[model samples]
Target: MHERIDEQITFRRLEVLLAFMEGGSLAKAAEMLDTSTVSVHRALHALEEGVRCKLFLHQGRQLIPTDAARTLAATAREVLSTLSSGIRTTREVAGYASSVLRLGSLYSLTLETVPAMIGELKAREMGLEVDLTLGSNTELLDRLSNGTLDAALLAVSELGAEFQTIELFEDEIFFAAPTGSKYAQHKTIDLQACSHEPFVSLHEGFATYHGFQRAFHLAGTTPTVAMTVGDVFSLTSLVSGGVGYTLLPGRIRGFLKDRVHFIPLDSRFQMKQQIGLTFLSIRERDPALLKLGVICRAMAKRFGIRT
Candidate 1:
């Protein structure tokens, strides 16, 4: 039963008519719209008044679309498509505009994990691009949270509720010094005994330094820090050039030369820290994120990530 032709059509009522026409039943349209069948029917009736025509000609219990109804349905499809395109464009600008994943990582991981992750991402997606940055855990996490970075491989496994993370790997710290330094000769070194040795270490807030703090706490002493630097490589340079002895992550092995020696720790704290990928919880909003997660985990496994 259709009525007057001049009344305005509400978008929802138009959408409902389009849904009913495409879907072929009021019940299915209601389910798709997340509404009750009665509500769908009510809107369809109102749509008849708005358009001043019969949209669906009912046969027994089946509702079939009229020619005019099908025409209107095409217009509705266009509207929905336009809306979707706009939202997708905005997200693409933030993440997908370039094929590259804008990635960040802790200074320590730049030695091994970042390179491996990039290699794996490229192998899995031939010609895949990656734009990478290196920073301390705090800087990388801040960039990740602020949308400047799409995702990060960070060694800071414990952050408050602000971040979402999944395990990438565990990086073990080791006692290291210049090749001929006094402690470098030991079969097993006790850190507490060397508490007076001048040390080079990451700045206090860094994950490596936090591991240092914990390990030294277990040893019941603190090393004398001769110089405080902010990165693993910087600490390595300072140590290798005979600046000071520092506790370094095993990843530093990749950068080692004849200038330094690495001795595995025999400590109560184990001197290990877990590293992982961190992002905003809504990473699901980007399908590419899932692909990145898969790539990150695969690379982590190759690096012998425990979890």
Candidate 2:
């Protein structure tokens, strides 16, 4: 009987059982279901035989449900309710039930760029909802590749063949040190000047870390990295507290304005972070993404960033 149930029990059969339990008779269940009485009776019989138990008793033309049938019917109602709710939530997560734009960016951008972008997007499109994700550059790229993010704002030193990108701006890397430090007093300092200074830097996967490597390589010196951290904020705090000096983009200067000072790098060691908006090339025609691209370009131009 268990084997028969495993092979034959289906959602439709459960629904038929439920209708029969509620209506209490084959003819009444068929009337409520708008089906033939024969179909209802057959369904009930199949269900009982499959379970190897008498689910109903027949007296004259009336069908009364047994205790086991009542118990199964209650469980079936809960299962169907839960299944319906799961389907609804799945649709929402898949973006079928909402006007959500999944936007991704680096954690460093949240200090200014991300907030400004979100404000502009909301202003331009009424009723548009944004789902923002802030992560390391590597994490954002991975999410973008896997379709988890609809678009991303990130530093793009090297463009991937499968991505469609709009150049937003180029930010020059600067030497960030504690206020009143020797490097801070110089208008432009050569990277080699601080080659012996203790440095705090982001981890390897970060775009800024790559720029740091490029700076040292061009200067013909290696930095004495005293500590490594995960995010830009922590790196800034470490620099402000006099932990060590580090190289970072000028865009973040506003964040630790009072606690830290940024000086330009010499031409020989100059490195620029090419920041842009990126999305899969296959999503080029997405209307929301197109609108966002236009907004980002406008913001970049307003800030005197080369478009």
Candidate 3:
């Protein structure tokens, strides 16, 4: 029985069972739980199998709970309530009730932006422990929406309506070429001039990929992309090795200075990637988030980024 419960029973299934008990019908339960009737029916069947009991009677179009079902429902309510209390207590004891801030950002920001932000945050909030996650723009946004991250630093254009964002800085996109390449001699180069050159780009989900697209679109031409890489570092490394040219933000130029030439695009083909801090609108009043927001704004100003 214990094995059966462990394999089949889940908190979501138990919640569904309780909702079914209260609503007395699959459709009603689905409506009350904001799920599909089929999902509620499936959960009920799974619950019955887990407990090895016939908890409901199928009477025409309605489901009537058996005595066993009512008893289990009562037990479930108590169990769920106690579990909730246990979780709350655990959080309090672990000092995570409010002092833990889970922050996420794009992989590109890890080198400088993230470290500086973490240092500033620690200086201001000595008791706060920050858990940082770095991923692609889409992955970070997904985590932010699902409550896995308290806030994220990402491209401002990628933020959705569900988030409230504070613009931190703008990174101008530049054409990166090998140091010895002919294009390296110019302060600014025309996009069309590089149209035939093999280009290395980040995959589709990256904000830099979008910037690359915009630059080419403005030039009214398409690039001959030879390869695609995951992160900015690798893409730049490829450019430095003379594999192919690529588009990247000006900030990375300092590190890749000797290896590659960072050339500004002609005015008509220039693009800027807007970076910002984003969090759920509902968490606007969270004290930790508020403090982080203040720190971000200050850092933006210090870096000469528009507030």
Candidate 4:
């Protein structure tokens, strides 16, 4: 009879083996798992040592499972599957949003994107528990890496290697003003032409603020930021009050459409903010996390937030 492995070989190590077998190479496995090939190899070595046998043999640049490896692989598949099912089901029994889904986003989405999404989730995930935190991408990333968030929606310049991402939607920063403003009835206004208008904008340290600045620089214009605020709703409110005209996502109208007016920035180059969901690839085992991602994708599409 085969001896049981010491320290139980860890569910993570078993997952590496399963991923390797399916991918047929350590590099591919690492790609799928969002880790380095070196890490995957070391995990497999430790797993094989734990089992006290060779689980795989290299064959002409390919990894092939041995007979024991085959048997153990099949067993591993079932063990992981059963364990996963138990954990997933247990989480459901506990509650949906049983824990907080730590979320972060650009300041622009706080008005409609965040509130609407959370409201919809509560309506559907009845009796589910959720702990919500609102912050910019940087603040949220710090929390997410520290395990404070299971998943978050954030603005990204580019994706990194530590997490998996699902595209939510692109928010084209529309030029906004009160109905009595000069551009109120214009079909579309040129972004560059607004260079002279006093504008309300997000404060620095927020991603959207930096993004908008970059876009303005690219357009070879320096905007006169009449006011620098923290939240998107505030920006819209200020605009409606005729404090100053500004650029915001079209979706923000979900809350204050009656008070604000939206006109597409018909610039030769319009700035767009990408909003999407992000989470550690390791947490994919949590069925609740996966389910929320699925729901969010559907939500984004339904609300026309998906590109």
**Highest TM-score against the true fold, candidate:** 1
Cα lDDT for residue 174, candidate 3: 88
Positional deviation of 165 in candidate 1, in angstroms? 2.7
What is the descending TM-score order? 1, 3, 2, 4
lDDT per residue (tens digit) for residues 17-54 in model 3: 88887787899899999999999988988888888889
Write down the TM-score of every candidate.
Answer: 0.79, 0.67, 0.68, 0.63
Per-structure clash totals for the candidates: 0, 0, 0, 0
Residues 171-253, model 2: lDDT tens digits: 88999999988777898988876798899999988899999998899888989999999989999999999999999898888
Model 4 lDDT tens row, 1-307: 9865688489998899889888988999999999999999889888888888988787886668888877877888999999989987866554334555545565556666677777766777733355667777777777778777777777766657788777778777777889778898998877687788888887766666776787677778998888988777777889889888877766677757877888877766577777787887766666567666766777778857653
Better of 2 and 3 by TM-score: 3
Question: How well is each residue in 182-210 modelled by candidate 1, as lDDT tens digits?
Answer: 87788766877888889887986688888
What RMSD value applies to candidate 1? 5.3
Question: What overall lDDT, based on C-alpha atoms, would model 1 receive against the true structure?
Answer: 0.78
- Model 3 ranges off by over 4 Å: 1-97, 158-160, 305-307
Clashing pairs in 4: none
lDDT of 2 at 18: 87
